[model samples]
Target: MANTMWRRGVEWLAAAAADPRACKWEWDHGEGIALLEAGRFWDVLTVPDRLGLLALDLLWRPGLPVPGPTLVDTAAGRVGFFLPPDPSGGWVGSGLRYAAKGSWVAVPPPYRSARFLEWLIPPDGNGVLHPPGPLEKALREAHGALAVLAPMCGR
Candidate 1:
């Protein structure tokens, strides 16, 4: 089952790459990461680690729908959530960056860790992506929560 999931994850990721063959080759040849084009299969919504961690906590509570694939760049102190493409490109918030249309993203293999990057929530191999509405709400709520805690932390 693990192997099947691993292969499916790889296939799912590769299908989003500009050249799926090359992407698979790179992953198969021990490259450890594949640079994939954004907006092909999904758009990436990135946030600072400070806000993202809090948002994740809220999203993961029981009875909430599971969020799509999420990743973190430890060295960069950023977290990225995969969401379906938004033609309007209307996502807007403090500290939020949308990668879509022409942007690129470095993605680690679903089953392994990479330097400075790792999957917080690995892709489920079912092409699921976070819905923009819920994500925006979670992020906004997270921002508000952080604002409340900031003074308490002397920030």
Candidate 2:
């Protein structure tokens, strides 16, 4: 079931990229997961809103935790992982913010390490967020695949 949904996500992304009028999108390659953002509301709305894209399950994966209180801004067409609060005023942990405008940012260390830095990419191809155990290798593969597929999609 999960695999089916995942594959559908990949297919939808590919179709969106193939359409010349499809809005631009990007993703961040970070510690826990890959965060994706589509520049226009329609592009992103087609996924979570209309298609009901499921959240990637990461419970069994060690060193990679599912982000808490994830927020998707349907209006701004942005998605972000918010850091939980601590006893102190400061954020207890780090989080990620991906804007459809092609900007990705992550809260720096103490909150999290440099590994959490976001990697931006066009919204095409397969965008899988492999767990932390094999993050580096997975990212390389995903990025390479996206690069090859992006041009064909008119990205």
Candidate 3:
């Protein structure tokens, strides 16, 4: 089941890259596990944590440890992205977050160093976060950022 869902995430992300409406950070959340607790902020769980939580059978109504602002919402900026808290006071933006395994970030390929929230959240400015021009531009420079990440993700 996890493999199926993971595949869906990959497919959704691949489709997003070609979506005319898909901005710089667009993604489909129906492809991932639903959050036990919904919020703007979320912690990226490691494989062990994920297994442990899944074993709970999640009877509590409070919620799950998963992430959210799922791609289910078609409205602009409805997507939410969360990063592991840093000195930057956790994540301060909203969009399709990448909280894969042990990291809450994406390298967009070629970048050896991993970035926490900087991938989606800019260091400055009040410009609209969606379709982050800088991130998109950087990815474009590397022949499509998400494209490079897809194969690496083993999707």
Q: Which structure among the candidates has the greatest lDDT?
A: 1
Tens-digit lDDT track of model 1 for 1-155: 98888788888988988788888777667667899988878899999999998888888878778888999999999999999988777888778899998999998888887788899988878898887777788898999999999999999
Q: Measured by TM-score, how close is model 2 to the native structure?
A: 0.24
- Model 1 ranges off by over 4 Å: none
Task: Please write out the lDDT profile of model 3 over residues 40-149, one tens digit for every residue.
Answer: 22333211222212222221225323222112122222223322323333322222243433342221211111222112222111112222232233223433444466
**Residue 73 in model 3: shift from native, Å?**
23
Best by TM-score: 1
How well does candidate 1 score on lDDT at residue 4? 85
- Tens digit of per-residue lDDT, candidate 2, span 89-152: 2212122222333433222211112342321221122343323233223334444565687799
RMSD each, Å: 1.3, 17.7, 18.5
Off-target runs (Cα >4 Å) in candidate 3 are: 19-66, 69-155
Which residue pairs in candidate 1 collide? none
Model 2: CA > 4 A from native: 1-63, 84-146
- TM-score on alpha carbons, each prediction: 0.94, 0.24, 0.21
Question: What TM-score does prediction 3 earn?
Answer: 0.21
